[model samples]
Target: MPSNRKYPSLELDVSADHRPRIRLLLREGIIAVQLLVIASWLAVHLVLDERIATLGAWGPLLMMVALFTIQTRTNSDNVWRYSGLLFMLTVVLGFKLIFLEYPLLHRQFSLAMTVLAVVGASLLIRGPMDYLLVAVLSWVLVMPHIGHDDVSDYRWYLAIFFAFSISLGWINSRTYLRALSITLQIEQHYRTLSETDYLTSLYNRRALMDRFERFIESHGGGFFMMIDIDDFKRINDQLGHAAGDQVLRVLAARLRNMAGSHCAGRLGGEEFGVIIDTLSPAIALAIAERLLEAVRNSREAPARFTFSAGLVPFSHDQALADILIHADRCLYKAKRAGKDRVHFGVGEHLS
Candidate 1:
């Protein structure tokens, strides 16, 4: 049985792209650190003449900053990524001094690094806790590889290898995780954009209607009001689209705030719809009046336009279509009575 019985929301994010990028970065960093440490170890004896290893060891650190900048962190997790980078740095330095072709090491040094790499790969998927788990797992993986002539013969070198492996694994895993996190966020944002209205930051008509049906089913019955602004076209004509945009935004805010737990949405253009879970006609009227006031306050016109709402109650007996028809007629009566009131119809409401 899986520990995670509940699944996470399938929100695709930049983290997917990030996982690959982080992995690549860690790989490059570890490889570079490996080369530099090797060169530094050789230089100590008769290995190399130049002190180039000093520059190389720090080169990966610089790349880390650049990679992170491109990764664009959303929070504190961004700053912590470098901690893992430093761990990889340790691994490389340790590998060069103890496990390499020469030097003084305990026999277990090289064995430790191999374990570090494998466990680090696993921890890379786990995110931040890279240090402890990756380090311990590396040691467990290393013990089996020790040989008589190995660096284990120099017990001190073996300890260096252990510490070094842990550092390298931590650093490598950090970059990998940062990238994964980013990709995940990106995927999620994309999915939201598909179902959401970008302008008002609300659910679009599609989402609203879908949920409206669910609300009706859940509560056994309810009311559905199809609301439209009486003269929204005039606003667009007189104030320009931008100002019209502000009006729609203000109107949407008012509706959402007033609707509370009821489902509300911009059906499209300057129109909105609402679904409320209640059976009493009095409860319905109160909701309708509040909704009207919300729209009224949002407008600045002395001769401000108002919406005409058509409310249809769903009884256990009526089909959704019949309820919509009755509500539409009541809405027509409200509009015919001068366009700023809520009207209800158990049957068709005559103007």
Candidate 2:
């Protein structure tokens, strides 16, 4: 059947609108890494010289706590989450610069870890604007230190690493967006296959019932119809099963066209169901008559054939099973009286 399924629009930039679980995992991973860095720094200082480790370490630790708290409570789209990460990074770099006095190698190792954290955070933020903001801010934070005698000799290496980190983060983000788009397409394809009938290209029984239930819940009432081809077995026996299939397919197309926006589906064998969202019984009956006329005049069928239909007005207060049973009874009556006519349940008075 033709699908009315809506899909997400694919864009060039990566955002939190796709694959939320993956974004959550990446956020958690960044937080965990920051916590590891803080713990390791505290442990090393405690071993070498407990005096230097003092209350200064608390600044970075507290910043990490605030970052984690923001991540847990807010979504990626929140400005507070991005601001918190930048604030935490500033606190960490500032703390290292002012409070800690370590060797050149140790300082380089710490800066490299900070760069990694920035790259991870970049993945969680939206688009190029946020990414550029992060890249510039990180570079500015480390710029003053580039001239310092402690690590001035390795400035070129630091610059290269920064460039590489930015490139890597952008590439990863684009790759993630592409993968998410493909995943969504595959999911939509499979869902369409599951809901559609193979032969007649109409919604299957399960899909039709689900649509009927949803319509009842939303619109409060509609007309439910059960239609069956007259003497379908005779057509199959005389004209062969291939001709029977063609008749079914042609009739389904006519029904779908006549029903317009209403839900129409194959209910197995020669029986089909339609749900029309309308308050007027006359309008529903007119549509049913048109379908019967269309099937009767169709040249695609092996020979002239007619169908019987039963239509019932459904309300929110009525059970779906009861409505189907009532419609089926009306259909049975139509077949018994004579085929090629419309039968309607009680409450609909026609002249």
Candidate 3:
């Protein structure tokens, strides 16, 4: 049976290609934030004398160490990342409430810390569920203290600040996602252009070979059919290049229809390749003959044309160069025997 599997598109390939870079950026951002936190801790120690015993002084440092360990030791697993962020948030809020004596300083520090937490959460967390959870938790932790002391005067102000910070973080996160989506799309477009033949809209030589290499590696064995248009240059000489181009395009469409787009590619001008995922050479040859007849009978072409194909079965152990050489030799034999025929590497001939 013919395998229903198809080649992956450039979009998917581009996403996979960009994943490591995205992870690296996230890792770097986390490390930078860790350094900033250490700097803040030093600055706080210089200015403030009142401390909540040793726990207040050391709690944040311990949390930072834990977070650093998580970030460095793991592959940025979301569970660990979110757990670290939540742990840091709890420690920051708990320490700020306890250490700062002045109600106003408490209020200011609490709001600033919560805002920073939200912004950080936005960067680390992709979905709003985790982000919203962080925001809501910060609000809950900070709300009871809003009415406790002289800070009561600015209760409304603090509420507004919380709302504003959450909104800002959400917007920032959405913008980041939108920009990332656009970047991936653009990269996929360029990648597709690079991999595709401009004329036939089929995989170009390099891309085709890449696909062939991957197929052989995965499937272990298959058949390769190399096709060349008979007297293709004569079309350009007699009817002009435009007509020749039209004929080529029509033939490409026929080949794609017969062999499946993922299985077919244009190797270069007037030549194409198809990978057959069948075990039997007889089935592979049948497919090649069908393609020949399809191109011959195609009504869309500006001029009628036929193709010669060299079909060779390959095993996973066989190098692509060797397979190509054998197929090309068979193709040369078919051309010598006379054009518009199929030649098999196993000494079979069909016209």
Candidate 4:
């Protein structure tokens, strides 16, 4: 039989400090305001003083406090932290319903007891309308239960307060969530821009270097190919720089179309470097040939332009700089070995 392995716990993963601060502040705000309407709570609790000892009565109380504590402990989504207000309302209402302590805290704990059910329903419901309906129904059912201290009146005041409070809370949470989502999306876009070339929308030189460093550290296998467009300056000399820019853009697009998504852009006058994620020397050479063919075939000028490439797949004992130097040396050899060709660590011409 194989022996089971036990992993030892080492470090605790914690969220950023601001996350906890936000949870704590929101929970404090909700608890502060909700506890203020003490008139009805005191009225109900007076009727059943000894019921506090029962699990039914104390369970909801303990759960509500515990929920608030958990909400403030971690703000990050990965931490299973509660959305403070919703959790507080949930545990409070759920415990009340399960314990049927409605007669005790009337509206404070009992009036909005359906909100507890709404929070609970949120867990079960798949869409917005389902939870919204639960909330509406809970509010509706609690309508008859809400009234003034006097029976002579229809208890319209309590109804007005309940409706106003739920409406305000719902709208506030909706607006807050919308703003939060938009902010997150904008932040993500900004992060992408930081790592990519603005003109080409390709991974910039910095990002490419970072990836190369990681690959080297991991002993990753691949081919790093250097490509240079033949007679790029001659195009600019004959036509204007605008034409040169157009050709460069066109070249970038063609390269992208050839390589698909696994390509990066370094700031080059007429050169581009690609670290192809291929383990096969033959496959890397095939791609180099394909790129050479595609670029030469793309745009025809008065002197028909073509590209020269140098591919380095592996050097088991070579340093990183040595690999680049040799690849570059081979690139110049291809250029000298007559312009339009591909070289893989030798003078052997690519057909």
Clashes of each: 43, 0, 0, 0
**TM-scores for all predictions:** 0.56, 0.66, 0.73, 0.64
Q: What is the C-alpha lDDT of each candidate?
A: 0.59, 0.71, 0.73, 0.56
- After the best TM-score superposition of candidate 2, give how far the Cα of residue 186 lies from its true spot, in angstroms: 3.3
Q: Candidate 3, residues 22-113: lDDT per residue as tens digits?
A: 55656776667666766677577666665624576677767767766676557545655565566557555754555355666665566666
Estimate the TM-score for candidate 3.
0.73
Q: If ranked by TM-score, best first, what sequence of candidates would result? A: 3, 2, 4, 1
Best by TM-score, which number?
3
Off by over 4 Å in 4: 1-54, 57-92, 107-109, 112-144, 148-163, 215-219, 259-261, 300-304, 314-323, 346-351
**Residue 19 error, candidate 1, Å:** 16
- Runs in model 1 with CA error above 4 Å? 1-127, 137-156, 167-177, 217-219, 279-281, 299-303, 315-326, 346-351
Which candidate tops lDDT? 3
Give lDDT tens digits, candidate 2, residues 129-166. Answer: 66666665765665423334665557787677778877
lDDT of 1 by residue, 1-351 (tens): 001112234333334435455545455554454455444445543443343345543454454444434323323344435545444444444444334443344354456456545444444333546456545654653353455464456667556666676666666656555555655555545655655666665668787767766666667677778777787788888877887777776766766676433767777887777777787777887888887886776654433567998887776554666666676777778889899888776555434
